[model samples]
Target: MAQETANSQENSNDLGTITVEAEALSIVTEGTESYRAPLTSTATRLDLTPRETPQSVSAVTQAQIEDFNLDTINDALESTPGVTVERVETDRTYYSSRGFEISNLQVDGLRLPMPYNNVHGDIDTAVYDRIEVVRGATGLMSGSGNPAATVNFIRKRPTDSPQASVSGTLGSWDRRRLELDVSGPLDDEGRVRGRLVAAGLDTDSYLDRLHRERGVLYGVLEADLTDSTQLALGHTWQNNNTDSNMWGALPLYDSAGSPTNYDRSTSPAPDWSYWDGETHRSFVELTQRLSDNWSIKGTVTHLDMLSDTKLFYIGTVPDASTGRIPNSFYLSKFDRHLEQWVADIHAKGNIEAFGRTHQLVLGSDWSQSRVQQSSLYAAATEDLPPLDEWDGSYPEPEFGDPDFVHDVTFKERSLYSAGKLDLANRWTAVVGARLSWLDHVGEQYGSSQDTTLDNELTPYAGLIYDVTDQASLYASYTEIFNPQTATDRNGDFLDPIEGTSYEVGIKADVFDGGADAALALFRTEQNNVAQLVGNIGGRDVYEGADGITSEGVDVTLAGELTPGWQASVGYTYLEIEDAEGEATNTYIPRNMVRATTSYRPASLDALKVGARVRWQDDIERERDFDDSKTRQEAYALVDLMASYDINENLTASLNLNNVTDEKYLTSLKWDQGFYGAPRHVMANLTWRY
Candidate 1:
């Protein structure tokens, strides 16, 4: 097996435990710094092998997020596999892969700028230390969108011995958390190294009177002057806050739409309606090395977010004589602001062309973003009555009659470049492109042809074939372009929306190296798409002709097939079509499945056990107000976890989520209706130094 991966990278570079240290490399020993190795043994963003990247890549480690005690990042993307995360309120969250919606995000690998409203609730996964996902259409290396997946987030560096760790958690609604991480060598010939991480969280949510608080800080610095030159610097900061948050979603019936049963603590807004939010982020990066195969890297980032809201929606006849109670409209204030910037430059090497070794990459990227929104509306009174639940002690309504005031702005800019060519020794190829420009403006206080501008060009390509060395076969093509910021059915402004995706895959690393598998088939097409030409004061305005297509097949499996056992699985099968004009073919069931398993018992080396299961199938919407409405049904869920390790720096954990508290419905919105988070329990403790 290629001499067992070259004797496992020469026993991880002569047992220096994968020495890292590189700022220009002065390390005389410790495996002699072979370009700071360790990117999980090749596959560093597609140099291939993770059974040859091509697509559908998943890696989530920090020991699988502390062996599944998974402290958010949406619980480590639920152990990834065609991901789906929808928390749409409680600080809003929505993620989907394969079924769309997942605007490629990246951290260490750059890219990040998505949040056009719907205040992402401050994405906190406790400052990441690992998390990677790449599924379908990564526009070569992420530039545009939709083939659904791309996650990437890796941070945590600085090592040379001195280590420190701390963790604490208590879950289920009144959650609490604390985290700290520290790392070694700041001098003393260690060529300067450092690391720090911090986190704090406080929660009290599960709907009905929500609450949240968050914080994160990170720092890293590394230096090594000669022997090939090296220097690194890093910084990160984050903050999040939320108070009684909720905005739409949670009303699945009754206005004659049928199916309605209430009581999930029913809260269609009324304790005065107030939702608040805040977010801030900063980042920086640099890496260099000019010889022995070459290298260079740089990154800069900044982000700011703010939101203030007062939402209340629930208009479906709740009393004008009982018509099934559901009337309470209000939006008396909503504000938003977002800003982002990004820059990148890169180069990597390894040559020897047609004769053998080849591995090259070149990159360039620049990004910009700005978005602002201001809104105000009010006009609902029939002697008040619309606070069925959500009791975060309300008290803030009062806007008797004034309705209409709006302002909006959005801007985007981009320039991108990418390349990869491995060839020789199993072929690999990738190419990328992106160039975008967009602007939008909207004003209403009596509107007057607002403003808009658009431009686009997104492209990507991929190919990989290693039919042996543990199997591989792949193919990809991608593109996406979006524009048109609201206002249509005659209000003008709507165009720019194009999408395409095609993928094929087969990857393997089964029972010989233990486990890893993949099988994929995909097809996606979207053109202009934007239907809905009705409601205009109750929201929902669309016009831009439609065209949609989705086809899918995905299957995945992961890791350790024996010794102490471990497993992961995912399955998806989807077929959706709605080709414009008369709403043609539509078959929506986007089948989904998930599985997880774990066990540790090599003569009891600190106990462990795990289990998880998930299933989906049941989504039928024929909108335009009905075609036999059915939204979210078909469900299955299970989870369990356990851990214990009392030596080498403490450990204790337990988790059980939705362990059959199945009242499903992870998301739905035509004005709220999101549930899922029933049975819950969490406990954790860790200390390491």
Candidate 2:
């Protein structure tokens, strides 16, 4: 959406002089709304507007979440641009950006480690107000990760005025959802406040006999110890359970290496297969303001996560005509528990430079995690049932207790500092560095192992020039390192992976700062990446690659165009090559686009309508087993939504996703393929007070 301005001109010969004025809003005194979340703290731990920060950043705000009816983090990320998603099974998903998997995550400025295989990718978004993403390396703040991107979740806080909202939803596949949120002052002076949020969901999937149940609860308390000091404590919990979940994707080919197109509703999971997960988190934060431009903050967090599953593994594809699948008849049980502690302390202030003001921040952080896991697998001697027409039902096996397997611990500590200096009239410089240390230990089956990585420094630097009142040009360089756990053929861990990133871009705020836009070009090079190799004697091995390179361009636009219209659009183009100069990671699209817009007519006052669309180029993958390549054709999906206000406190809404019911593959890897979801419809009613 674009705002229009009218210009008037008068002839001085026939009349007096005429004057004209610009209609754009001034940045000095403008306030941002929910639809236009211009300010973010993800870039440098400072509250700077997106245009002012020397990086490419994007945000999905509360308004956008409500408009699109996004219920989980996976949904939100799938809708975000420059990000790619792959589904391994019904409950397992992975995300990547710019040809690299995303692994860095933060909550309220504190880093939180991501689980292996993404068992927690289905986190509910009800406890968060906004999700911010910064594209490029973030080693200055996160310490270690890929050069892809960093994601930060901003939690909802207590409000000064008493407010409450409740919503109920009914959708396709017997889906049901309910949510409640309340926040207000706990005392008359508003010095003390509290907030609570809760949600429950029960949904059946398009895959036969597959279903999920989830529940979440979050609560927080904020108190003002003094006028310039604040203390906050909060806790969040989530429990998720799945029934008849598939362990992996359906087969993609038969014995003849020809395609076997499985129906979208087909699943090979046994009736008794299940997976369950639970998480608990507690955090405390304190902020002390030494002066108007100086402050100190400290935060501590604790997290406990547990997961358990029982599944049946299928190893062979059935004959297309027989409708019978051969199985190894193995029953497996697995359990994992993780406990983590994280803490950070920092101080930031303005400093006097060469006749100008500058900014500086110094921080230190420590994190530790302990993980325990156990598993058991038993092979059946008897032949499995065969010749049965494929259905989502099978008899449960009798596999009793199993033995304990593994225990592991990991620790990390770091110190970091960053500064922004006014180099000249229209130029600024940003410099930062981080020093980190890592330690890990593992014990399994009466064997012990330990690894330590020490004294690694990551550096960051950037340059910015203000070209105009509402536009800026910037360039930056950053470095990152990641430790690998994969072992080589000799059963020894591989060396850490290293990467460097370079970026240049221009960002602008237009239409009186009512809209924002950015264009960026970036390149990244990585070394010592782990590549899969053949398995030997029931053990898998990997070998380190010499190097890989990725280059890409990104364009983004967002904000309010006029009085009642809002829109967002983004496009990405990326290419990756291996050390042999061959195309790699072909599962990710080389080009993609995402756009959404909403409008509310002034005459209709209480009604709103919107639409969304996603398009991607063709994707190709090569099977390592058969040395055959397959390609998925280009495709697009459309979604529509509308809402009406019944009164000041009540509203009703409807969302129809995948309107055309397009059947397409979302991911292709190894010898398996995954199908995208079909058409879905959701209707909701909400009440506010």
Best by TM-score: 2
Kindly give the stretch of ten consecutive residues in candidate 1 with the minimal lDDT sum. 28-37
**What is candidate 2's lDDT per residue for 1-689, written digit by digit as tens?**
00111211101110011110000110101112235556665767655677767777877767678888888887777667788777767777777788887878888767776645354427898898767788877877776778778787777766656878999999999999999999877887777878899999999988878899999999998777776677779999999899988777676765556676777877767778888999999999887767767778788999998989887766775555554556655577878899999999988778896799887888899998888888777664433333233555566666666666788787889998887888998898888888999887887554554667788899988898999988899998988888787788898888788878898999999767778899999988888888888787777789888677889998988888877787777899998888898999888899989777788889996998988888889988886446787778889988899999999899999999999998888776445666787999999999988
Model 2 ranges with Cα > 4 A deviation: 1-33, 115-117, 380-389, 400-404, 443-449, 485-495, 530-545
Candidate 1 lDDT, 311-394, residue by residue in tens: 765545333234334335555677777777777676666668666665555566666666556666766554334345334343
- Give each model's clash number: 16, 1
TM per prediction: 0.32, 0.90
State model 2's lDDT: 0.76
Which residue pairs overlap in candidate 2's backbone?
25-512
Please give the distance, in angstroms, between residue 651's alpha carbon in candidate 1 and its true position after superposition: 42
* TM-score for candidate 2: 0.90
